[model samples]
Target: MKNLDYAYLGPPGTFSEQAISAYCSKYGGKTHACDSIRDIVETIVKDEVDLGLLPLENSLEGSVNLSLDLLYKHSELKLYREIVLPIAHYLLAAPGVKKEDIKKIYSHPQAIAQSGDYINRHLSEAKIVYTDSTAAAAAEALKHDDRAVIGSIRLADIYQLDVLAENLQGDLPNATRFVLAAKADKDFSDKNHLGNNAESQFKTSIICAPEVNRAGVLHEMLGEFAKKEIDLSRIESRPTRQRLGEYLFYIDLMGSSEDPDLIEALNEVEAMSGYFRLLGSYPKTVIK
Candidate 1:
């Protein structure tokens, strides 16, 4: 096994950290934790790490805009692979503190947003405080008895806190999709699963923008995919951050970029759209 040093979002206990650990354990690698997603990206860009794991989307919460924005901002980084982790948010507090004693609940905005209905139903009186990361929320809650943090079970265990409530998010089918990114593209020929092509599935992600002063341009852009009968799994628009009204669309399609049909669709979209950027094309992880 080659010694692989991977970067992940952490001080510890963030879902990104857990995903990195799980990925490393399953694929044979060593991991290093970083303070922020930007830090992880910086590590990868600087060649300090082999890969950086980041959360791109959550099933319950929708897109992680910051990650998407960062993807746009950092042109050097590329999506090498992706993985999905089952999400389980817990209400954690210091040992001996009962759930009723909690006056404030702290967590990342995404977590708080996803678990809003549950918080309103159960901890309605509790004030919500947003932290940079879920692990930071747990660390903050550890210092006070009146605060409970909504985070993962791994967070509670790492911080030696008690789980006041398990699966507090209310949504039982919660899951988060993370991307494994690196500065260079990946070649999967040496991977273990190459021998078995039975379950192989690939997905390609791209960012594109439609041309200005063009009527029905968006329709024309999409028509390219429709004409090719390409399956677009997801499509989202984010501000291009260039001008006030300019926007960029992020798309996920169900076939490899190498596929002939997908290639034809992409070429057409590229010719029609003002700009386009291919993030990556890699095997899809089936979340069980």
Candidate 2:
């Protein structure tokens, strides 16, 4: 493959960078940092970048709303793969700044939310300063010895900060799901698979909007997959945006889109739903 360009949400030292590091190791891509998640996605959509490493959901914080909203609205991008990185927040302090010495906590809102219980219990006195990204928070920690940041462990090396306390998340085993997206293929249809890696054990994602919007329409659409013994791994609906109460159901099913059982279920669902979109298929990996 050509040397690919992978854009991520970062300044540096964020979890998205770490996830893309794992990806670039496999795919031989050069990484680029964008100011916002929207920048990353729009660049990928416009072919300014080859791939976008985007955080989709967190084990503790539910969905990353900005990422999800972007994906939902931009149906022209294909989800190339899914990366599940175990999120371990570390409190990085400046030199001589002990746990008790810290008075200000710099963190992304998501990081703050994820570590809320621990903060309330242990370091309740510290003032919270939310930044655009965790790496940005890491930047803040570097300036003040009395301040600390909750960010990636790698930030300690990048910013030369000290790890005051590790494993500060409310849940010790917290993780975030990231998706790699690229400019979508124009001609992809029912017969074709999204990628060669998608030929085996994989997951296919689709967005569905029911035709009639009547009671039980959603239930019946799901029943199509349930009856086929095709397990639905995830099902979440986002607003369709055309009208109030209108919504689109985004689903992840445990098979390739080309799989016979999956094909049958989707066929039934497509007929029942007014709108259906195949958001590509990809293999899933949980990064340790």
Candidate 3:
């Protein structure tokens, strides 16, 4: 694969950093760390990077709404690939600190929530502090022996902290799905070098805004896919923002856009909708 420029969230030790790092290791790319999801998307739109990786969903947190919202807003962006990274939140502290010495805990809200049961069970008395990102929490914890952070194992190494507890998240094998997006015109047909036969395995994503809100209209729109027997991996609605009750439907279906059934079903849905966008058909990445 040709080397490409990539963007992701971080200062280092963030899950986004890990996700993009995995992709770069396989495909060869120069990575740029951005401050937020919006920055990553904007960088791609501005052609500052060849691709940007954004977390789409987590098994524990459900969905990252900002990423979805940006997908809906940016017609120029097309998803080219996806990556699933397993989340392993660790309780980290300065060297020489013990569990009982942790008077305060810091982490991103999602990290804290994923590791909630453990925190409540063992560190209930500690003050919970939320940071903008898990890496930021690790940086904060580096300042004092009394503070601890919940983050990845890499964070402990980056911040020179000790791992007080491993696998603190409530769920075993929790993972987050991340997508690689680029301008719609970017070409990435060179998959043979990456060692994965990509064309055969794909998932198509789309967004549809109904022209009107009527009884059973939503069901009728979905019927097109149901009639074709297309397997939908996800279906969720985000408000249109133009109207209070109106919404745009976001869908992920298991098939390439080239498939006859999927193409026909999407055409039918678009025919009955005022706004429609086929985000992209991307190869399904197997979690390792």
TM-score of each model, in listed order: 0.86, 0.90, 0.92
Model 3 TM-score, 2 decimals: 0.92
* Residue 261 displacement (Å), model 2: 1.0
Q: Please list the Cα RMSD from the true structure of every candidate, rounded to 1 decimal place.
A: 3.0, 3.5, 2.3
lDDT agreement of model 3 with the native: 0.84
Residue 247 displacement (Å), model 3: 0.7
lDDT of 1 by residue, 240-271 (tens): 76777788989998888999999999998888
Model 1 has an lDDT value of 0.79
Winner by lDDT between candidate 3 and candidate 1: 3
Candidate 3 on 1-288: residue-level lDDT in tens?
Answer: 467888888878888887777766775788898987888988998898888888787732223888998888888999888788888889999999999999999998888988989998999999999988888899899899899999888787788999899889766557888888999998777774232754447899999988888889889998999999998988888988878989899899988899999999999999999999999988856445
Q: What are the clashing pairs of model 3?
A: none
Best by TM-score: 3
lDDT of 2 by residue, 121-198 (tens): 889999999987888888888888789999888889888888888888855457788888887863323222223353
Order candidates by TM-score, high to low: 3, 2, 1
Query: After best superposition, candidate 1 residue 210: deviation in angstroms?
Result: 2.9
For candidate 2, what is the lDDT?
A: 0.80
